[model samples]
Target: MMLSVFILMTVLSLMMKIDNSISANCYTCNPCPTPFSPSSYLVRNKTGCRYCAKIRPDGYPIVVRDCTDTCEFSTWSYMFSKYSYNCCTGNFCNKSQTNYPTHQMVILLLFTIYLFVNKTSTKI
Candidate 1:
């Protein structure tokens, strides 16, 4: 019985480490400053990123795209130019400005789980 228990523990430990890899992927771009990044490069599984994002600052022709923790679309104006930002959740979601948040959708369900518990509980 002791040996059986040890084997079970080992199996569980291995399972825990198996699925930590991030399956989500996104297009990362930063064509500015030293070590310019290509817009076609694909990025996988950032430690704290749940969503992909794209932002274009005012007055600058460059747009930077990458992973983000949240999706909050907003616009900010600073002097001459207006910056527009858009966010979405899914794999390869932040691909382009006109792509509208995704081509290869991984789904919002991937990271979120909803439990629809009934408000009424039967009493025995």
Candidate 2:
């Protein structure tokens, strides 16, 4: 019984450690510069926007002659089409991101139970 308890605690501690490490590396938004053009509408793209602007060589008196919406933002929902759009815009701790850790916790819980049962039923 004591051995089983020890093993269970050890496994739980290890799982918590793993969870902390994984969450530490989780993705977070960084303040990125706006890459959109005043003349053109912005659209989502893989890397960034791709538009043509006609500005003077001296960079004065800019004009919005033509524009296109070709700007893209870094969002988990955009990256993972399976996830809902709200996953990225709202809370950071959503199902999409918690799936992995939740799965790990479930597996660890099952394993711990199994170990406890096996240890108790074993005959010396």
Top model number, TM-score:
1
Taking every candidate in turn, the Cα RMSD to the unseen true structure, in Å, is: 11.2, 16.5
- Model 1, 26-46: lDDT tens digits are 556554322333333433334
Consecutive 10-residue window with the lowest summed lDDT within model 1: 110-119
| List of clashing residue pairs for candidate 2 | 40-67, 40-68, 41-68, 41-69, 42-69, 42-70, 43-69, 43-70, 43-71
What digit string (tens of lDDT, one per residue) describes model 2 on residues 1-124?
Answer: 6786687778788866555343211112221113322222332112111221111112332211111122222333233333222211111221131223345557777876787778788954
User: How many clashes show up in model 2?
Assistant: 9
lDDT by candidate, in order shown: 0.49, 0.35
